[model samples]
Target: MRNLEFKEKMHEYSIWRANLVQAIEMYQQWLTRYGMDDAHRTNTLLNILSSLKNDRITLAFVAEFSRGKTELINAMFFAESGVRLLPSSPGRTTMSPTEIFYDAEGGSYIRLLNIESRLEDMSLAEFKNIPERWTQLELNCDSPTQMQNAFKELIATKKVDRELADRLGLWNEREAATQGVMNPDTVEIPCWRHALISFPHPLLKEGLSIIDTPGLNALGTEPELTLNMLPSAQAIIFLLAADTGVTKSDLEIWMNHINRARSAKKQGLAVVMNKIDAMWDDLGGSNDYDRSIKSQIKASATILKIDEESIFPVSAKQALLAKIKSDKELLAKSRISALENYLSNDILRDKRNIMASIVMRDIGSLINESVNTANTALSHASEQLEEFRKVDFHNQDMTGKLMAETRDRQSLYMANVENFQSSRRVFIVQAKMLINSLAEERINEVIYAAKHDISKSLTTIGMKQNIRKLFDDLRDLLQDSVDITNETRRLVKAIHKKFKDEYGFKEIEPILFDIKKYQLELEEVFEEGEAFRTSAKVTMTEQGIVVDKLYSTLVAKAKVILGRAHDDAISWSNGALSPLARQIKDHKKQIEGRLQMLRKINESKGTVAENIAHLEAELVPLKRQREELAIMIKSMQLEGQLAESS
Candidate 1:
């Protein structure tokens, strides 16, 4: 229902983000209208707006087969469909990792990637961009039956010979036999490796993305699920069957992927004890399963090493039935509203804070820079107006005196300009060295070396050794980057101090490039890589599958992060000295303009009153700009505070 608590909260969050984006857009227009935008600053602002426009609160659903992950999704967000949205039937319903969200461009569609794509070295991320690679099926959103039938494709499977299954690393003899489903002739594997569904659901339309992942075998084989998608989610809901408590496979998924994906403090993690209705005692009182649910919650917390507060016990099937039949009593018994409240309040609030931090990181410095430049210009304008007002127009000697003062100021500024040019040459040399070290060519060389070594390795153990060596090389690259970054910071700092001390420039600190954040990111990547390297699934997988998984997950992911660091370095070097340099240039121009104005009056071609009026006209806009800039900054601050407290 539109009045559902989760739906209402999601709507509120979307409106809040939309309003913030409007404020940001207005600021961009204000900068352009005032002729204050530079190439670098404008590009940065555009990038920030792009991030905001595409922002979504993503929650990943992770579990072993039949933990009711897809069923919970159906109850929580798609209950309005009045039937099961995703095919969450008995055993391995969602065979592949499926992402459900609204795509503005594609509208409504079911895009499935063929499982054969896993045979390639490309990652799921790369495959997403190549639309032709996906089998696009029309999704009739207006017809729930049609949509439900189409979703059955998510659970579609094809039988392949055991040899083919082994090559694909989907035939786990031990795992299959343990489940008593061993077959020598044929093995069933998902028809698709990944599915991307762009549906026009209301909550999804409000920038809510849901990832429904498969069982432990899939989690182990598909590194991207653990290494990329799971971590990127703002919240990860791990499902466990309440009737079975926490099984060995459930605990395996917890320890290896879900536990490793999050922090020790367990932020953004919710363990859902689904199928609580199965534990309901018909012979007992209304609160029959209350004690049973609480007992299992404590047991799950202890086994998973998370707080009991993080575990939610709910009946997805009952919740869906309640909503469909408009039965409030059943819904309460389902306890689905509690989980809905958590998603609405807790998860959405946390997501807002994360988004706020990103906005602050990207645009905060640029805003400060704009404010500083405007203040300095306004101050200069006031000084010019004061000097003109003090002039005695009838005293012709006054014009020559003003001209002489302007010339002296110009001489001092030009002296510093000459010194800046000489030091700039040295700065450019050091900057090149810093950027070249982070160049694509250099990054590729390391990647190529690692892949080549892995390809050459004859045995699985040798391949594992090669992967370890690659991480060492990657870490070494990061360390070298850190050293160069520090070197550049010292060089830039000395140059900044030079201009301030020698030229009487106002105190302004250069925004130095930060490599520590990137280092920390790479360190986490290394930890995950090591975990993957040592995982039994990876080591025991076929060599080709191992290579494919490594390329798509560990190697491809790191390369992307490193690529970002390089782009940031380029942006930093270009804009590092811009604020100070612009000020120097502006100061020189102002002095020259004043001298020209005085010469006109001294030559009897212009009146002192006319020049003073011209400066007065300029001051009006400058004053208005200052007011607007202050308002914009205050609005962002208030919005960020509200995000935290709300």
Candidate 2:
């Protein structure tokens, strides 16, 4: 099959490879001739060249506490192995970074940073009996089974006897007696405080690495892990409990962190509504299981402002069991099959296809071919120029021509950065406008409508209940509004914090300040109306409840009026405040553009500087080579002339 796209990419990669090879060869030749063999310099250049050619894809799993991050991972990959990478209990499992890489020869190996090897071989069961030195060791095994066995032996539950605990420095009688409880922090665990499990799984072998992160506190405490590793991830999957829906913490994470860090390329985010099984019991008579799921999905979708399709409601426990048993029916029933399909089929394969088609096939081949052609011409010209250098070359005609060509090519490459920067600015402005329109306008309208509609429903129910009960109900309804408003404020604060911290801008603060001012305005608007008071004598009658109909009607009317005002406030805030956000975003983009430009300029300048140095170094040798060639040619011509004269 003559695939033109593939052929083109291959061609580009080939040219890049050839140019890199040629560069290496030229450097080596220069070093050899000058007797300047600097191994360190050569190695650095080689590493830079190699990194340009190799690329890899990564997928990461992340979430808040009790979100089943580890369980979801187990369901996906470790089902057959029956080994949990992270602790699944109520307590925290992952205290530090644990990487699981595929080791073909060694089977599995745990590499510890500062730990000793002697303590690594002990089984998990024996861990409680071992001294502090045991937890310091790095453990590595060939098989998952072997690793699990070792772990079990090392953390031997049976070995948690008083003597063993005392010897291992886990038991403190005085502290325990006074405290009335064991201190988890002070207790020594046999398992490496940081565990790394590497095995040959089909998925992992295929370059699918899942990082099961610790709780929110741990993630926050470890900045390097989130800042470095999380950003590098090609895809991130966040899990939330289906029963709880999107909690305050979940919303905080989304608004503060994940949403801000998202990019169009190499960044995919998915939310898994895990533990769907829990919702099956609490659902009311009118709430069908599917309907309940849909409602939860809708609620979550509203909170996250994401498509319903993006949130996959699943049972991690059932999924794990199904995968372990290889039961397709169970997998399908658990709804985890959708997640599996998304990951294996949509995410992994889709990314590979795109990479193959775009980067590897098109850009790689094109750049490679262009570079190879340029290098071949440059190399040939250099050789020819050496010969012409000795004869004075009729006023340096040959050297002048070659220098002009090099300058022309370099200039063309330099212009592309400006073009890219201009296009990026335009795209960002449009994108910001679209985002503000949806987030501020559409969302505000929906929330306002919902609030008023709920208030109206409360008013209608007041006709049946006594005045006291009606007042209590109104209070409850108002409390719900207060709760929602508080939640929104919390979300806004989270967003504000992230914006200030990451981008060094106070973008959300102005919007939130506006919101607070608007809320006060709304309260003032409502206070102007008559307020309802509860009374004990107001009992229900057959005709109708003796509730304050006028007050109830006024409250409902106030909700509708204030709801519109709230929405208008949101609109005004968006209109007035969004420009600031956009400006910040624009400035950020500009900064990025400038940084990219600086990088390119630096790279180009570095290349040029290196080339100049190489040329300067070779000048003497090239002159000598030209001189030698000139002498030989002259001698040959003279000998021929003499022979003819004789």
Candidate 3:
């Protein structure tokens, strides 16, 4: 017996199947005069039909440089050296965006994007030699051992020679020139700057894709990371070194890139107060110090307008090293335990909520549609079979005539049937694979790259100087905005007081109204200024990533293909297939017309599925951020109460 859920699902599927049948009939009539091959045309129709599937949720990590982003990734994903994605040093390991996903049969695959390759069937080591393009390739494997070997091979193949690195902007050419290196030979290496790895992980398999973006400045500089990737994220984890607290860059990031784009109803942001081990000695297990730290956290949250609970103070470096050495004792340490608990509980909870919402709304409908379309095609095939069997081919003495008619009818009917089955299989497989791939890719490309690059950029620029400059700029802006607000308030007050005195009015109603208006205007100006600051920061990040052109191009291509496929399917089914049968030929045209109407319905279903998938992916990060903000808001209220009590 079918369960209630299954029955309901089947009902929904039936509706879609009926709609699909009508579309097929219409497309056949439209294409009858064209004499196109039934097999090829039906294949095209199936591809269009498959678009009515749902997408999955993908989680990504984004933050500023050198805040232990990569260390956190290692702690979370690559505890074993053999499982690591990229070589983490004090400088950049990834210069481009990469994605990783899982393959069918529960194995892992690595897919590197934007790499130029000349050789077919290249090994992992050979990936390094490819030029950079927007193309991608896939590799298959499983287990930590396999992953480790693949990583090693990739690194070996793609290792940037010091001389080549300098020329390609990975290393400082000016510094090399100063060292008396003249006329060094340049190698023609592939422009492939990013690596993508796909792995089978429990969380990822469950429809979560984690993306780790580059450092703060890097994120800010990369427009694609923000406009294309970050906005699409379900949850964003912003990491700040605990010792530094929320630095100017962190503040800038929040105000500019994160805060505005976030949905308050959805948990969208979490601040990871990392490198807490550095503060361990200073804390000294003192209640006073703990209280002080908590107080400071609250104060910071209040100023930043963030939730305190979302601020997780952790030592990513210690956690990663502990995991790497497989030291159980170290892993059990309070700091490590705290971080782990938070991730498993608070983070996971938000992820679950987002997933549930998506499943109920988007994925559920898509699954139903896919099943229905398959059933509809099956029904049509059954009808065609019945018709073929009833035909009196035996009475026709001419074997050639009988054979030709049978072949033509069988070819057309079988083609549509085969195409439908193939499409259903491919859609289901690709959907699952895309989800798994995104998680592994993010860990390798964003997290690892940020870890190395942060340190390198800091060292190159002189950390103290750069930090000071960032702080000075932030402080000046904050002070200026505050000063302007205060001045405006004072001016409004003075005008009200003067007007009341001159008019000899005790109520001063008109003056009060004017003052209120001026205050509102002032508030608007302040809001605009805040928005401007955020936009400036986001713009910088966009410049760094160079994703604007890429995103636009991809989106455009997807739209065009999807549209053309849908239109072609409807035309072929309605115009080509309805004019053959003697008794039903006129009725066939009517059936063909029904197929056109069915096309519109199926197209709407496809659009709905796409929309739902996009929303589901977005909800995960948004919910997490919202939860973090809620915690900070509660902390701020508590602090206010304490200050009042005192």
Highest TM-score, which number? 1
Alpha-carbon RMSD, candidate 1: 2.9
What tens digits encode model 3's per-residue C-alpha lDDT throughout 1-646?
Answer: 1112222333334344345334443444433432322453455444544532222344566566677776676666556543444544554533444444444452555545433331122322335455353243334434556555555433323444665443333443454578886555543233444556656654344344566665553343333455445655756777777667777867877776676445343365667777766665544675654664576677668767777876776666666676667666665442555544554455555654553343233222222222233333344544543443444333444334545654555455444445434533543343333233223343234323432343344342342233233323333433443443344334434433443454221222111111233233333333433343344332333222222222222222222332333343233323222112111232233245334423333344355345334434434543443344334324222324322322
Model 2 residue 201 distance off true place after TM-score fit, in angstroms: 2.7
Q: Write the per-residue lDDT of candidate 2 for residues 1-646, one digit (tens) a residue.
A: 1112222333444454445445544544544463333443344345444543443346667778777777777776667665654355454444444555564554654443322221233322234244453333234434555555444422222224554444333355665777786544344433333344556655455444556565453343333344445655767788888889888868766754465335333237778999887777553642577788899999999988888999988888778777777777777667876666566445555554544333232123222322332333345446533543342323345445544554554454344344334534643454344334334344445444544443444443453233334334434444444455554445445544644665344233333322344344334323322122222212221111122222323334334444554554343333322323443434444344334433343345355445344444544654554444334324222224322322
Candidate number that wins on TM-score, 1 or 2: 1
- Residue lDDT tens for model 1, 1-646: 2228778889988998888888888889888988777887788888888998999889999999989999899888888888988898887799999999999889899999988776787888889889999999999888999999999999899999988787766887887898898677998888998999998888888899999998997887788888888988989999999999999989889888887788464778888999998888888755767888888899888998778988888999999899889899888888877777778888899988888888877777677667777888899889878977887866867766777778889989988888888777887888888888888898899989888899889988899999999999989888888888999999889988988887878877688998888887788888888887897877667776777778788788888889889999998888888777777777887788777767655666467677677768879988999989878767665445423422
The TM-score of predicted model 2 comes to: 0.42
Please give the lDDT score at residue 525 for candidate 3.
30
lDDT of 3: 0.44
Best lDDT among the predictions, by candidate number? 1
Off by over 4 Å in 3: 1-55, 80-86, 91-94, 105-109, 114-193, 260-266, 282-296, 321-329, 332-646
TM-score of every candidate relative to the true structure: 0.94, 0.42, 0.42
Better of 2 and 3 by lDDT: 2
lDDT of 1 at 55: 91
